[model samples]
Target: MPYVNIKVTREGVTETQKAALIKGVTDLLVEVLHKSPATTMVVIDEVDLDNWGIGGLPVTDYRRLAATSGQGSGSME
Candidate 1:
């Protein structure tokens, strides 16, 4: 069995989007690694913005600083 964990901020994400993510991940594994969809598992976790941080700052603060500094988009890939 293949297990995958995906974490994102606690922003408003629709259920349809979450379903798509799970399906996409499963499909990717099937196509790339010959994994079976029945055995592939994908779990998503939503973390609070305050609980998520970057560069010693919360995501919200990081985005604010990034906006002011014009350094980065503050988007995680």
Candidate 2:
């Protein structure tokens, strides 16, 4: 059995998007590890934008800046 726990900021993810994320990861695990998708489990823990920081800036605001500038999200600093 494969089990994965993912933590992501809540700003950009929707409920279906979250499911797709889990599906994609689980697919890989099942294919590569020969695990059963039915038995595998995936959990996503959402955090507030204020709780996730990148390059000394909040991920919430960083996403806005990235969209405006057409830039990649800032890296951890």
TM-score of each: 0.92, 0.67
Regions of model 1 farther than 4 Å from truth: 74-77
Lowest lDDT block of 10, candidate 2: 68-77
User: Backbone clashes per model, in order?
Assistant: 0, 0
- Candidate 1 local distance difference test against the native: 0.90
Clashes of 2: 0
Residue pairs whose backbone atoms clash in candidate 1: none
Query: Which lDDT tens digits does candidate 2 get at residues 1-77?
Result: 87899987666678889989899999999789889999899999988889999767887677777778968645531
Q: What lDDT score is found at residue 19 in candidate 1? A: 100
Candidate achieving the largest lDDT: 1
Compared with the true structure, all predictions reach lDDT values of: 0.90, 0.82
lDDT of 1 by residue, 9-53 (tens): 989889999999999999999999999999899999999999999
TM-score of 2: 0.67
